[model samples]
Target: MTDSSSNTQETDSSQYSVLNVNDWSENWQAGKIGFHKDIEHPLLVKYADKLTGGKSAQKILIPLCGKSMDIKWIADQGHTVVGVEAVEQAVLEFFTEQNIEYSKETLTDIPGDVYKSSDGRISVYRCDVFDFNRSYKDKFDAVYDRAALVAINRDDRERYATLMKSLSAPGSRMVIVTVNYDPALHPGPPHYVEEELIPKLYGNRYNVEILERSDSLEERWREKGLTYFDEVVHFLSDKS
Candidate 1:
């Protein structure tokens, strides 16, 4: 996922802007993606059963997915994985580095392109997440929101949440992983997401539950002057 803007957290609602796609592209081009993890996220692996509901061939959506290894992992489990990303560089790197043979085609209904794995199990849409709309309404059975929500600007959350809802089918489940820290210390692509914000975003359509919270402040964040860091996991079940 592309986390936009400078390191300073913006408090004024008026100052918040839509994420910068070019910034993300630049990051990818320059190899400035420290946010990219080498392995599957530990939290995601820990809670895979909940996301899949012990079922196979479920349709899954990953928003702002930046070549996440989890996409390949989930697809290997016999599920269909769909990822939405903005930067072409990240998308290409994903397939090339993973050694997955893929084909690409431009999307007629929307801007950007779609890349599909030869196995037909994984597809990644190279477009801004916001541009992907209700055309995919009720398409996914579950969502894995690892870096998407936290990477978004605060002002766009409602729109983002609504988009998520529009894409998900009835009874769909979502697993979210968020990193929390004092915004005063450092601005973030992985911004501090307040616990209260979860319900505010999804309460109308989903039952939200706090699954776990742990101290996850890495040494780098500590060196950046953050006093504390908390990583939280949330589970959401559609109300319908």
Candidate 2:
């Protein structure tokens, strides 16, 4: 399966059928992750300070986190990392591939199990994002969303943001990476999230700032019928 920050060669869009949300687990199980990246996202390194908001130690939440290497990078930075993934195999691959010793526990309260590093610095919950309970809201001090929103259908984008808000602490901040493109050109797993929509989604609770924009991905994804492929980075924090 592709990591959220897939750095591999881009596949022709016509080569595959549109991804169905219900088939996410199947996709992972089948190793259909052309989107996966072996390294941390450049933006995560570039805007670390802003995401952390000068806080030295934080509990960061990652939604739909596949076995991306960024989770370890975040943990290496002295912050506790909590990730949510729907596939158990993905979670296992993360720990096994990273050589991190971890223990798994079934959560009686939730539909899935919790896997944590031996040091307790990182935890990943294996469950559907919607199955995630609201009682745990306001637990994370920061959030890192890379391609998660784009991976979902348009109908679920707003619902995704609402869940993220619930997980954020009062003064939490986030670094969200999205692609800005003409949606009418190509349907996407890396969907087009127009700049205007960011405000409508997160602006009600936090101040949103556009940190950077680049068309570097046009070369890789142009075959997908994109006239322009912009990688937009945003920093969001509570209004308070």
Candidate 3:
């Protein structure tokens, strides 16, 4: 499901196919996740102060979190973490490497296998991110969105934003990290994320702030034969 396909038909078909738990699981079984980060993203590390505000004991929602080490960091800092990942392999790998024993059970609420790891510090639902029932909505105090938004096609951006908003409690805080790249050079899962789209998506429901914008991804993009990489870290509050 995470494959970067130039085939518009295949890509369009994925929108419907991804909703099926079995088909989505097959995508994971096929090892199609080219989007997983090898390391915890630097922006997430650098903006730790702004993202978490040195606060502990908050529950954080990580959308499309694929075996990310960021989950552990947030959990260790006294935040309970819940993440939704469509890929089964990534969820399985997360528990194996983190050395956390987990229990698998069917969630009648979401129609997927729910794996609760590390004494329930982390709960990962192996299902399409969009299919999760709204009973889970407004249950989180914070959100950590890394690659989920831009990884999706432009048409799905509003749905992504709506789902994120639903999960967040009033006055909840969120940090969104995205890379802005040129479409001509590298059409991608790391797709073009217009800066303006941020506010249009969440500003009506949240107070938005751009914490940083820099060409930090330059070295990596240059290696891929691309120029002009813009990375942004945004802090949002549900105060509005």
Most accurate candidate by lDDT: 1
Instruction: Using lDDT, rank the candidates from best to worst.
Output: 1, 2, 3
Runs in model 1 lying further than 4 Å from the true structure: 1-18, 134-138
List candidate 3 stretches off by more than 4 Å: 1-6, 9-34, 135-138, 216-220
Q: What is the C-alpha RMSD of each candidate to the true structure, in Å?
A: 2.8, 5.6, 4.1
Instruction: Count clashing residue pairs per candidate.
Output: 1, 9, 0
Better of 1 and 2 by TM-score: 1
Tens digit of lDDT per residue, candidate 1, span 60-131?
999989988999988988999999999999999999999999999988877899999999999999988988
Which prediction has the highest TM-score against the true structure?
Answer: 1
> Where does the lowest 10-residue lDDT sum fall in candidate 3?
11-20
TM-score of 3: 0.84
Q: Looking at model 2, report the run of 10 residues with the lowest lDDT sum.
A: 8-17
**Each prediction's Cα lDDT score?**
0.85, 0.81, 0.75
Q: Is candidate 2 or candidate 3 better by TM-score?
A: 2
- Candidate 3 scores a C-alpha RMSD against the true structure in Å of 4.1
